[model samples]
Target: MVETVASLSGNESFDVVVIGAGGAGMSAALFAAIDGARVLLVESTEYVGGTTAYSAGTTWIPASMHMASVNRDDSQATAEAFLNRAVGARSSAAMRRAFLDAGPKAVAHIEANSDVKYRARPFHPDYLSELEGSTLCGRALEPLPFDDRKLGRAFALIRAPIPEFTVLGGMMIDRDDIGHLLNMTKSLASFKHAAKLLARHARDRIGSPRGTRLVMGNALIGRLLYSLMQRGVTVLTRTTVEALHTGKRGVEGLTLAQGGERRRVSVTGGVILASGGFNRHAARRADMLPGADAAWCPGAPGHTGNAQDLALAAGARFGEGALSHAFWAPVSVRKRADGTTAVFPHFLMDRGKPGMIVVDASGRRFLNENTSYHLFGIAMQEAHRTRASVPAYLVTDSEGIRKYGLGMVRPGGKGLQPFIDDGYLTQASTLDELAAKLGIDKTGLADSVARMNRYAETGVDPDFQRGTTDYQRANGDANWTGPNPCLGPIAQAPFYAVRLYPGDIGAATGLVTDTNARVLNRDDQPIGGLYACGNDMQSVMGGVYPGPGITLGPGLAFAYLAGRHAAARAASPEAGHADAREETRAQTS
Candidate 1:
């Protein structure tokens, strides 16, 4: 029942207007509608899901109802303690508290009122498991698989997953699906599961462009979209906001343009900015993240800081004191058949696996290879200051490559010639040969390899302690019957390597907002009828990537807060004025 508009030629009115059709925007629109407010969801792109669709869809919400299903010992107090140790003073305590308190409520409300549902991941560990009060599981939730066949022709409206992430010409798979597909020939149950998936995908290809079996972030987006459609929300895609119409009270309306036609839209509740972030903004990137290359970034393209610019012009200031201006990950680049560059983020797939070692230009190990992708990226940047680590080499021998794969190279090592032909992957028969081809110190490379071999034999990486942490161990091959799951000798011939660059995944510094998710002015006063969430709002983690789905977790929670606050404002207009003044006094004081 969703109204998809092509041209905006008439003056319209809505209670809540949400910019960007990402997870945050969709959640905000849904929450507002649930509160009896007429909602409008807008997107600059043709599809609904943003960078989220390209992700693994791990939502980190502590102490939710699903937690006890996995780990009954998980408590809000324990989660808070973990945050205190991991995040500390990098972000505001109030914002963190607000997220913790509202997260479960948001999850519960959405599940109760809509098609969206989540279950706790059985063994998803916190990235920083070494930190105090960290639990092995129960915090991160996974979206259940959704049938896109229910969407019919509307299936195309959902954004497709990354090309490299899919298999069999766009058949999307999840963690569970991956295991089954890999073991299909060996196990009967896995074969049945994989057979069913392949059968469904084959049937879907007959009519649709891709598979109708949705999982991960696409499932989350599809569920949200379906829920919004059921509620009759108006969605306008490929539309750009030209201007904001504001009065003394605050943002009241927006000037939108679609297909060269302009229309004025009034909003009685508020405008919520969830337009990703400033990662794609050239000016912002130059100002905030110097020396970072956009070619390395794998985020969605619609996040160009357009909404943030409007808020800044209205006196909204960016948050300060973040450890880094943006979140980052180490990515390998390759040119696809479509002539577009594919920047693949190396997160938890091959880096932490045995027989892998990343080396700098001097052919020296500069970091713990098993560390989180965010820390790995930061280390690359930090190492670049002294040595040439911008394009670090991820070296793995033939055995390793065959077992774990490198970058875009799929496991089982069937289609490696294409990767090598495109110069995306470097292959050499010997360690010294690889060093020579990569223009690195041959002696340094040999020494590093020897040291790694010894460490592998002893099952202790004394240099960087690769397998010391629980997270690292979990990321390794559990089937390995060795002293250390994350350690293995790189003695095989025909080494493979892929170049890695630091990629800014999302912005951490963005428009400042209160605990209620209302955008604030330069003087710390709430801008009535205005709000921000997702990457458009400054990260509550203060630029730290604590665990999987950190971005989506806070994004959904704050979107709920903003939606409820805006709906209440719509119910009582006078309360908006009083709440604004009270918030101003409280923040300024």
Candidate 2:
């Protein structure tokens, strides 16, 4: 059962104390609890599931038991080769090997012992599909839809997904559900599916603010919370870890503060730091992500780097030589009724669709619009260096807006007046007028649109090669009858546009850890009783966004390793510590 800091009697002891309650930390707590260790899960926020709850929860765990269900030809070797080609010298081979080795074991272990279930996505491809060894499917696993009602009152502990992402006044839906809902009137199977969802959501609205039928990230968190409840893991929300007490053996205990009361708890096993990352840490944000606007970042709030700071004070050092400090996405911002800014990431919805083009202030196409969100954000920053491209324009015609929508505007172009009034979306009847409103060069905009129309007829984007890759083509309109699914003439009247900014989705540079996820000091020696995972640890990909769910993939694998290692330590404290010290030394050397 979850309780506040008031539940602690000030004399409690635990075998494992996980400092964060996102997917990584919760999984660590579960892995420890299942291995017969008393575990305590802590979250500074009132709710659990940090940035993870806001995500799509697509985990890229290769060679799992579920992989064969989608792509039987995929293998660990192929995934490794893809990682090598994609990640290259950005990260460590040893760390990547550790992640690859433990991925299937971690998934199998969690499923066998808990209610957390996952199914391989039939068509989710690697982000960089053009690279060698990249498969069309089977590496990515999506969490099965979970009934949040099973969590009982603890359901409130799960973080709510972004309000804009829901429908019908808080009905959460997944990719499959979206298809059914969109095609309900055309197909019987789709109609039945849509009807069932609507009926359940209607019933759920009586006592709940949102639907009880959770999908995507909510389903993943719901399953984890339910499993944690069954294991009787002590979960403390709205609690902060004040300080870490270390001895010759390493982290021995920590001070926790909650509700104006403080308590010191002892841990015989270890402390796992999975407190998101430094995305919101003011000093670190300025130092690492210099000049990046905080309003542009859409990550969850609990990642203040408090735990990371505590670790750094204990001699921990951040990893070096990353390609980027954080993962990136081009996001569109809008003001909510609550007066808070809503930063919506443009991922796999409109950018690659037909009849769309992203342009700089000069109204020139700067990148392949069909590129991955990470690459698109990188392009924005690179283009900004040369000209005014920080707030780039994503312009589409009337047909595109009705079919794919623009930014915050929904499909079929419903309720667009409100968006226009709020200045979230800009609408104009012609390309020249639209360019004038967006402050783009009218001649450049006209030339660009003309080129796009010519490309649509020829089915080739010779300049940027938009639809040349598997991932890009998949994101385009498959049902589109045009010569190229990704290319459609932007000649329709009433063109629409939204401004885009590069948003840091999550942290990539973090505290250094060994293969076993043990935090390392400046000299690269393991802090015996200290461990880290998720964004709290240096990414195995060295800040490269190799594929879908790269962050969560290594996060889960290392969480498994940390949990199992902590449990083994609890069982044989002296022997486990000695073995770990030697192993870490060997690995580092």
Best by TM-score: 2
Residues 1-589, model 1: lDDT tens digits: 4343434447678889999989899999999999999889989998899988888878889999899999999898898888888888989988999999999999999999999999999998899999988889999997888998887777788999988898898999998897888789999999999999999999989987888888999999989888898888889888888888877457889988778677898888899999999999999999998998889889998899998999998778999888799888999999998999999999977988989999999999999999989899999999999889989989999889888888889888778899999999999988889999888988988999999999988999989989898998999888777789998889988898999999988888988999999999877778889999999999999988778889999988999999988888888889667756755574568
What lDDT, from 0 to 1, does candidate 1 have? 0.89
In model 2, the Cα lDDT at residue 547 comes to: 85
Question: How far in Å is the alpha carbon of 497 misplaced in model 2?
Answer: 0.3
What does candidate 1 score on TM?
0.97
What are the TM-scores, per candidate, against the unseen true structure? 0.97, 0.98
lDDT of each: 0.89, 0.91
lDDT of 2: 0.91
* Tens digits of lDDT, candidate 2, 1-589: 7776777877988899999999899999999999999999999999999988999998989999999998999899999999998888888889999999999999999999999999999998888999999988899998999998888898998999988888999999899998898899999999999999999999999999999988888888999999999999999999999999986567888999998988899888899999999999999999998757989998889999999999999878899888889999999999999998899999988989999999998899999999989888888888888799989999999899998888778888788999999889999988899999888998988988999999999999999999999988999999999888899999889999999999999999999998999998877878778899999999998878878999889989999999989888877889446845654674567
CA displacement after TM-score superposition, residue 312 of candidate 2 (Å): 0.6
Error of 2 at 80 (Å): 0.7
* Candidate 2's TM-score: 0.98
